[model samples]
Target chain A: MIEFIPSAFAATFSVSVLLALAAGTFAGIIIGALPGLGTVLGLVMALPFTYVMDPATAIALLLSIYVSSIYGGSISAILINVPGTPQSAASVFDGYPMAQRGDGALALGYATVGSFIGGIFSLIVLVLIAPQLAKFALQFGPIETFALIVFALTTIAWVSSGEMLKGLLSATIGLFLALIGPDAMTGQIRFNFDSLFLSAGLTVIPLLIGFFAVSEILYQAAVLKDVKLPAVTSGGFKLAPWSEWKPRIMVILRSCGIGSFIGVLPGTGATAAVFVSYADAKRRSPNPEDFGKGEPSGLLASEASNNAVSGGAMVPMMALGIPGDGGTVVLMGALTIHNVIPGVRLFSQQPDLVTLIFVLLFLSNILMLFIGGFGANLFSRMLRIPTTLLMPLVFMMSVVGAYAIRSNPVDLFVVVIFGVVGFLLRLNRFPPAPIIIGFVLGAPLEMSLRQGLILTDMNFLAFFASPIALILFCITGLIILNLFGLGNAISKRFRRKETQSNN
Target chain B: MQQKNADMLYGAVLAGMACAMFAHTFSPIYQNEFLFGDVSTVFFPRVLLGIIFVLSMMLVVKGKLSTSDAILTQINVKRVLLTGGATLITVVGVWYLGYLVMMPVGVFLIGLALGYPNLVILGITSLISPLVVWVILAKFAQVSFAPGTLL
Candidate 1:
């Protein structure tokens, strides 16, 4: 792994790769700085172009977008009261106040430096841990693998946006959708209704375009009755004095740790991490009341933790093939498009590629710090691009992406149908992430379960024979219990801790 | 018109769809009874459908208990329907007409339907975007486009 660092750099430093990084990161920041657009939307829009690029170039492009977008969101949070992304919601607590007090430049400085530190720290953790985690995952058998997928599926409840049952229903719908084509076990078609296109099964590209792109267009069109945001003037970076920052170093480090840990939990996204880190920072700060009041520590906690989550969220996706959140789910899809299936198999089959991904991620963050610092004002101007104009361009991209996948006219209908359904689902608070999770994991879960069942001679309880499987089952059971009421009890305890911290 | 109790309506629709899907999974078209696998093809789907059915019922109950958010808040339904109709026309246009002829027109119509006030910008963009995409993806990258029979 140490030796490959140089080789990884070699692969990543090529003209094409660097160009991709520059383009993706720049566009990502602009998208993130815009109020309505976000990291996920940026990623979804970029997916169309990856159909033509190589694996390394594609990953480089997507990783650049993923890392920089979190940082970009803070720019808006500081310059204006709005958080460009959900991950930046905590940043608004202090970021806006700093801006309100005419210290917006200083706030941006803290966020930039803090984000840089958080990104690098998480990368270090990723480099140290991902290979080992993947190695451990390779030891799992069919039953254990199935149990792990079940655990991963249960994580849908975590990022369900406060609607767990609706999330489960969406996942179930995804499973049903995945079952539409021919049976993998047997070569028989199931739910095609005699259509040639359905017989081939729903392609990932069209489904994603529908779910993320076209649906977003419809939703925005429906809901955007008026545009009301005022343009903000971005100021240059201004760091706090050393003595002022000395006390907050521990807050930054601890928040990174918190961010990384929470990010590794599937479906517990950066939004959650920022909140947890903010609460933790407030708890430890000597001047707790300074939080949400232009406090440097508050900005550091939010920016550091959210940026840290970019690396941490990739852990499970890279090591175990389970997406930790919506963004990684799309990345996983991108990998599949490039013929790089992300799992334990990826590490063994293509270690060089994996190393290159790590190297690219590191470079992306380093570039983000400089590019983001230099381009802050330019990114702020992105907010002026109206949704009216932006939505139309995105629609064009979606059409091309869907059509380019198979050049089938029927796929356009697929995009439209799913787009409509996805819009309705969003309105009902059934989050889209769970549906993608269910779709991505559907085949593996079914295959593993069926194989395990065959191996156990149809005895269901025999799946628990493996210690790994047993442990996973126990964890799943506990999660179910938590879903009922235990989670609320735990959250109440945390709330009490937060209240004490505020005092 | 205002959509009152949108959550309850959504729940009821979801339950109906789930029931329909559940029933469909049992249809003769999906049967794999003679297969030798431990689980039939229908087995997993049936389980998923059943879960969806139960969850939708739960959603209905939840919808009844809780006040619904503004799922349809100030949304111009007429605009939505028109845009949807325009999208359908775009798909059909691309199917019946070739990419070169239909794509720009489709894009322009879509932009117009979405209430873009500047027809000049919408028309210019509609024309330019498809051509640019075609040149980049189809011309440069060797991606094939759907050339309708009319072409």
Candidate 2:
């Protein structure tokens, strides 16, 4: 693979980075304020505009949007129980209660502070660690790439967030979707059935709009309840003072660390990051029960880690060309489209662009302070938008967005069909995330596996015998055991028998 | 809301999927002389599906479904159908009336269906929804969206 890295850091300054940051964050906030709108949709929808811009400027704008959207979701979750994005699921635990308790302003402030701290920490590491990882990743051949994807896929089953069956089922559905296109080995189409749309399987934009956007619109509207924001939250806004916040240092650092780890792991997404971070913060805190009851520390841990995860996910993607999270997959795709082939060699080849990316990453995280702190409360009123009007808009937007992907009627149709399928799956309590991941990763994985086999003469023994694959297989096996309640059973036995003594 | 313990449909669907997948595997493996690539590609995912199929069937047979974390017990079919139907209409309608007419019209109608009935609010909702998206998506981050039938 040819790697294209621009010359040394174009002698860029904080000014350009700041401008890009301001522009992107502002845009992200606006988009995020609209229910069912999100970072992925924001970034992907913005791709065409980048066609004419400098690579740095383009990357900066997109990265800023990525950073701010994580914070944007917090605005809604805190003011309204509805989480705008799945990652912000954690924010609702304490954020909503805080708002209800008349601490909406204070809760928003903490969320902003927590987001900034997390973003800044992850940015520093992204600059330092990404290049190192990239250099190492350049050494990988198709074998490693194939193995990496397999590992990512297997990880999803584990990340079913304590529900492996649901995860596997969703993943199976995804793989099935991926198989709809032509077979990689024989170049034969599987399920086209006289339609041109099936020839390309399904595009990401429409499906994303359908599952995440359209479905979300319907779901949110159905649950719509009219609740007023703090009649006036501005007067109540408080930072809680950093000196007083020092007790949360452990929570902040630990959550950031864990959040970054979660972000770097694919399929673990923000929702998982939020729950685990919240639980960990509570588990480690001096007062664990205070969580989910409007504790600022709970918000701190949840917000920081979740935001940090936004940046941290890029670490794996830039280094190994592996998508660290769903957002990074979009990022990696954006990079490739700009013809910036990922996987290591770019760090040495284009120090300038790399530096630009670093600066942009930093700028985006910092910009969140401005976006989340001042803009958040003002935007929080989106919760007040009646679902009746909101639902139709989301549906239309999904259709338009899906059709926009290829401008093909076929894609639009697929989006609608998937909308119904997605709705059906959701009704049945089937998680849609895994299936999306599956379809997204399936084709590439199948192609890679076949290519590897073709290279290795169809050796079935090759996959397991490889040390990395062996490790991945073993980990997947352990995850299965954990999901089967073996881990829970073991841990449960060790706990004191409070139930027996209660009587 | 308690999770509906009904697994009959879920189990049946999975079983059908498994049969199709297994049939695909069998056709290619036995009928074709050249099944290159590792057999695991064939065996692995299928075995995985077989396992899934069995698990789903067991769940269905036992009727042991659980909805542990869901806040809403049972989904309203009327709500789903109305929403889904309205979206389908808007999507299909756009190809004919164009994005502008269809979106506003769709938003207005669906809004009414969902019980939002201020024409002023509905009109503003339709206009601003796409417009706001336009500014953020096109002007800021720079991606193209559907030009639809309308500008």
Candidate 3:
């Protein structure tokens, strides 16, 4: 790990890689600053472009977008009341008030610096944790692997949305979609129904385009009312004095810790982290009443934590091939397309590539800070482009992307079909991440389970023989029980017993 | 529609899909017994569909007891249908006319359908955007595009 750093630094400083980094960061900021166009859609739109590039350059581009988009959301949140992404929702509370009082530049500055610190802080944590985690995961056998996947899927589905039942159903549907192709073990066609396309199975890139990009276009069409552009009051950056930031150092650091830790958990993402950090900052401040009234601490907490999540979320995906949230899910898809399969094997076989990813992430975050500050005015102007014109371009890109993957006309239909399906699912409050993640993990889940079963002579009880598998199964059971409100029921029973004992 | 009724309908559709999937397990392909283990190709799918069916029914029951409105409180049906219809046409057009010719017209109509008032900007964007994307994807990336017989 220590030796890889110099090599990583050399690779990251090359011409093409730097160009990709700069372009990706610039585009990411604009995308993040625009209301309604978000990080997921931006990543989806960029997916087609990566089809031709090398793995390192492609990853650099996507990582830049992922990191900067979160910070870019704060720009719109400060300049206008609208948050560029859901992750920036907490920024509006104090950011807008600051802008309203003619300190928009200062607010933007705090966000930029806080985001930088948080991003760097999370990268350090990732560097320290991911290699060790991957090393530990090398001990997992087939049964343990299968069990871990089950636990990950269950936990993601259960926590990803408000309605646990719907999330589970969505995951089940994804698993069913995966089973549509040929069976990996026996090479027998199960659900093809004699269609050649079904036998060939669905590819990951087209599925991601359909699920995220096409679905977004349909959703915007369904809900978009009038194109009323918000008034941009300020358009540049201004640094606050050291005295102003000196007192809030602890707040920023604590928020980074909260954000990175929460981001490491499956399914929570940056949205929850930002709010939790914001509330923590507010609670700890002596002048708590100033929280929603242009307090620098509030803005710092929101911006810092959300940006920190970018690094935190990548840890699990790199080490275990399990995405922590939606953005990382897309990143995982991009990695798969580039033939950089992220898992324990990735670490063992291709340590250099892993280091390159770590290096790219660090570079992307540092680049995001400079680009975000230097190009604030230009990104602010990007908000003026009507969603009308922007969306048509998005649709065109979606078409080209879906077709570019395999040059198959049939894939276009797949996009439309899944687009409609995704929109319908969204209407019913079903979280889409579980479906995407489930689809990603589906083959491995089936392969490992069958392999473990065959090795153990088809005795299902033998799956529990491994200590790791037993622990994973226990965790999965606990998650399911909590999802069904069983935890609450037992806690209530205990409370009642305690009341009786006190009497 | 009320959210509860919509949820019930959604649940019913999911249950119907589950039933269809469950029926597929009886087919010849899935019925083949495995040599290595008792678990067949259909075992995982059948289990998944069963779980989906059960949860979907639970959703129906819960929807029946609750008084919540649909998740989307307000939807512009006309716009959604128009946008969806226009997109379908674009796909079909791309099939018949190819990407170079069909994309410009498709984009223009979609923008129009989505209420872009300025035809000048919309028309220019529609025409130029496709060309730029084609050049990047086709020229630089070396991706192939279907040249329709008409084109």
RMSD of 2: 5.0
TM-score of 3: 0.97
| Most TM-score-accurate candidate | 3
In angstroms, the error of model 2 at A420 is: 1.2
- Each candidate's chain B TM-score? 0.83, 0.69, 0.92
lDDT (C-alpha) at residue B25 in model 1: 74
Candidate 1: lDDT of A439?
87
Clashing pairs in 2: A5-A350, A8-A352, A9-A352, A45-B143, A46-B142, A46-B143, A47-B143, A49-B142, A134-A344, A174-A439
- Candidate 1's residue-wise lDDT over A229-276, tens digit each? 455755567778999889889999999999888888888989999999
| Per-residue alpha-carbon lDDT of candidate 2 for residues A302-352, written as tens digits (9 for 90 to 100) | 889888887678877677666645577667656765678665667767666
Q: Write the per-residue lDDT of candidate 3 for residues A175-201, one digit (tens) a residue.
A: 778777778888887778889999888
Candidate 1 CAPRI-style tier = medium
Q: Give candidate 2's whole-model lDDT.
A: 0.68
Residue A366 of model 1 has an lDDT of 87
Badly placed stretches (over 4 Å) of model 2 are A1-20, A30-58, A80-86, A89-104, A139-144, A221-242, A279-295, A324-326, A330-355, A381-383, A483-503, B1-5, B21-72, B127-151
Q: Give the interface RMSD of each candidate.
A: 2.1, 4.0, 1.4
Q: For candidate 2, give the DockQ.
A: 0.39
In candidate 1 the C-alpha lDDT for residue A200 amounts to: 84
What's the lDDT for residue A283 in model 2? 89
Judged by DockQ, which candidate is best?
3
